[model samples]
Structures are given as structure tokens and as C-alpha cells.
Target: MWGTTFNRSRSEQTTVPCHECGAQLKIQRSCHEVFMRCESCDRIYDIADYVAEMDDAMERFMEGVYCDRV
Candidate 1:
């Protein structure tokens, strides 16, 4: 009932706010790229831009990324 894990990516509903719309952003991925998306305004952002906002959710998601790598 929470975040769904896929083969190529992972995501979590995050407390991080979007830079443009000020809405909560979701940490998402496509293939190997990890980024954040704002559902309210349809905006995409590079994950590095929100490094200061990292928390448990982000930490867990990133760990999965590393596990999938060779």
C-alpha cells in the first residue's frame, strides 16, 4: 500500500517541496535516472538539487539503486 518497486526504478512520496509549485515532490526514476516529480504542476527536477532535503525515504530508495548495480 506504499511505494512500489519496479525492475528499473523505485520511488517514494517525499516531503521535499517542488521549486516551482511548492507542492510535495515524489522521488521517481526512469531507467537509470533518478529524479523528482511534482504532480501538481507536472514539473521534473534533478535529484541532486534536493540533496539538502534527503531523509529516510530517499536513503532507502537510493540503497535499492545500488543493490541493482553490478
Candidate 2:
């Protein structure tokens, strides 16, 4: 039988400061895809890319939404 496993890391718990609004960005959920929510900007970020740069940028940009507060 084939099975799927789910794992989480410390970064998943990382509430980074929003680059726009300065609010904390939190990890909402992770599965086949990862979802992050910015409370300050009220934006939902979905990270489906496996590439390193794109993934990092998406996370950073989403976090920035909170930082910029827009």
C-alpha cells in the first residue's frame, strides 16, 4: 500500500514580520499544497511551486503584503 505523510518544520511556525504592515504572517495549513495567511493584509497565499526561488519569493512576497499593509 502506498501512503502519504505530512511533516512540518520550525519555519512553518515562523511568524515573520510583514514587510508592509508589520503584522505577523502565520502558516495556515500544509498538504499537497501549502497555504499561508497574512493577518495584516488579509491575503491568502498558496505555495504550490517546488522550485526554491519561486517558493521563497512567494512566501516573502506574501509576507510583504502584511509588511506593506496593502
Candidate 3:
């Protein structure tokens, strides 16, 4: 029987700025990941915050809540 496992080791790596030190970090995961640890600053960044904010804004828009644009 052939079985496959969910392996993150083969995920693509990306370089992103560290929220703490502003250094580049190699993120070994997908773009939809909620959080990642910065290799340079050793700090955890909440990437999902932006996604959550967008979701909230979408919900508000669906409810007919509009914000004034400058």
C-alpha cells in the first residue's frame, strides 16, 4: 500500500522582512500561512492579521458599511 503524508519539508521558501529586526527571513511555507518566525530576529509575526482585517472589511462591505475615501 502506498501512503502519502503531509510534508512541509518540500514547501517553497520565501524571503521576507522580519517585523522586529527588518532582516530578511527565509519562510518555508505557503503564502496563506497564518504566522511565521523570523530567523533573524527570532520574533513571531502574525501574517494573518492582514487577512483577518481584509475579511472584516469584506464583511462590513457586504453589510453596506462604507468608509469615506480620502
Candidate 4:
């Protein structure tokens, strides 16, 4: 029952792989919003501009960053 709600079918989930290293992202919470980080390359990213959808489990959030180090 929990699986059906939290873990949707793999194909249906919107997973965002790391753009640089192709690593899975972990969710980190901020006072205003949430963000993603890649452990392998230490690349940080912002999945969405707003945090309104952060609580939804079914929606897979992609990681993104605001500044580019270059």
C-alpha cells in the first residue's frame, strides 16, 4: 500500500539525473526552498524555482544551482 502511494511505477516517476556527472541527487532543505546535490561530483543544483511542490512525494525533483562556477 505504501509503495503504491510513495513509489510510483519507475517509468512514471520524473527522475532528474545529474547533468554533469550523472549522479543521483539528495534533497537538502533551506528556509525558503529545497535543492539537490550530486555526491560524486559535488555539483549543486536547483530543481525548481519555487518550493511549493517540494512536499509532494510522487513528483521527483531535479537538482539545480543558481550560479555557475565556470
Of the candidates shown, which would achieve the greatest lDDT relative to the real structure? 1
Candidate 3, 2: how far from true, in Å? 12
Per-model CA lDDT versus the true structure: 0.76, 0.45, 0.39, 0.45
TM-score of each: 0.74, 0.37, 0.38, 0.44
Q: Write model 3 residue lDDT over 1-70, tens digit each, in one string.
A: 2223322241223344555687754423333333445666677655443233333322322232112210
What TM-score does model 4 achieve against the real structure?
0.44
lDDT of 3: 0.39
Worst 10 residues of 3 by lDDT: 61-70
Candidate 4, residues 31-68: lDDT per residue as tens digits?
A: 45446666779876674632443434314422222233
lDDT of 2 by residue, 45-70 (tens): 54332223244434544442322222
Which portions of model 3 miss their true places by more than 4 Å? Answer: 1-7, 10-12, 28-34, 49-70
**Best candidate per TM-score, number?**
1
Error of 1 at 55 (Å): 2.1
User: Lowest summed lDDT over 10 consecutive residues: which window, candidate 1?
Assistant: 1-10
Instruction: List residue ranges in candidate 2 displaced over 4 A.
Output: 1-13, 46-70
Off by over 4 Å in 4: 1-15, 49-70
Which candidate do you rate higher for lDDT, 3 or 4? 4
Question: Of models 2 and 3, which has the larger TM-score?
Answer: 3
